[model samples]
Target: MSILRHWPSVRARVGRELGLVLALAVVAGGVLGFLALADLVVGGETVAFDTQVLMAFRQAGDAAVPLGAPWLPTVMRDITALGGTAVLSLIVLFTVVYLVLVRRPAAAAFVAGAVLSGAGLSQVLKAFFDRARPDLVPNAPIELSASFPSGHSMLAAVTYLTLGVLLARIETDRRVRVFFPFVAVVLTVLVGVSRVYIGVHWPTDVLGGWLIGAAWAMACWGVVLWLQRGRPALAADG
Candidate 1:
């Protein structure tokens, strides 16, 4: 009798929360993809694609000279800087402050926690993998960190995507919600591509970064959905 009584409410809840299911599915795919890529990286199996992509960005006979106009590298450096630690940190700080000012302490806390933990995760993975940077070309802006899983690419995805989802949740308009996440995806893709073009990271390194970062963001999204499951209005402040 109790089971029969609960079935309708359970079905209703499931119907209303389908987005949560999708988010979880994405999280699963990202994790599995990242792990598979990592395996290939560790087994020395990514050389072909990585080499091909990196070499394609440079001139045929001169690896030091990138294929684009001389000014393009300068623009790429500026774009890549958007994903750097300093820039991302500042963005996170400003966002948290804005949320707090709007009396959204819970949202602020979640953003801070998610970004910090994601950054830590990136560091740990880089150290564990201990992969070397690409030497086929001279790195435009030299890097000192271990190379597999580009930090800039990962952090950009984490911070930008999380911020985008938060903005989407706060807005009630369907178009506005879609727009926020779309911009986030564009920024993330550009940052990852810049990492590859600059010669500081292997193609697989950026790929692994993107996969893990996306997984982390989607996991955060699932948490937000769970929090707002019954009360849609709570999306604005919490």
Candidate 2:
């Protein structure tokens, strides 16, 4: 009788704990995959695959001419701007300010720290790889930085996804929670695809950026979860 009475509560707790474990496992897997990709890229093992993919977006015979409609390049350029420094900075600033206004200084600080650290990490990775930009396309976006991993793609993932996760956590409605992360993912994907479409980054560069950026975001989220779990009393008080 006693076991039966407590079984439901025990099962519920087990289910919740299991879910956390699975989420942690997924984050770990992502980090490992990113590290593997970094190794392969550094070893120059993905050059042929990268070239083939990048060239696919170009004219069949002339690598200089991009494929698709006449206005595609213009559209892609606009999309890529979403991941650029100016726009991302504005978005981050607005998000931080909003969080502060809502009396969530800890959350705001976390967002700022995650994004700034990701940006610095991107730069360090680029310097380490020291890969040159592709010259296959004539009208490629002008860039003067090392280009193994696309910084725009990586930073966009970090900033947008981090913000999404944070916003999702505070939402009481399930639909709104789902919507925030969905929008963040769509933005991240669009930005990465635009980098490739505009011929600024090799396909593998974008892939690497996505991998590392996702890993970094997941890692940060894991840290946040840990902090929250360690402060159940404080959370309850708040």
Tens digit of lDDT per residue, candidate 1, span 128-233? 9999988777646668999979899899999999999888877879899999999999999999998888888999999899999999988987887787676643
Which regions of candidate 2 fall more than 4 Å away from where they truly are?
A: 1-23, 230-238
Among the numbered candidates, top lDDT falls to 1
At residue 177, candidate 1 shows an lDDT of 92
Q: Give the lowest summed-lDDT range of ten residues in model 2.
A: 229-238
TM-score of 2: 0.87
Model 1: lDDT equals 0.88
Please report the TM-score between candidate 1 and the true structure: 0.90
Model 2's lDDT to the true fold?
Answer: 0.82
lDDT of 2 by residue, 83-169 (tens): 999999999999889777877778888889999999999999899989999888886768999886899989999999888877776
Candidate 1 segments exceeding 4 Å error: 1-16, 231-234
lDDT, residue 213, candidate 2: 87
Strongest candidate by TM-score: 1
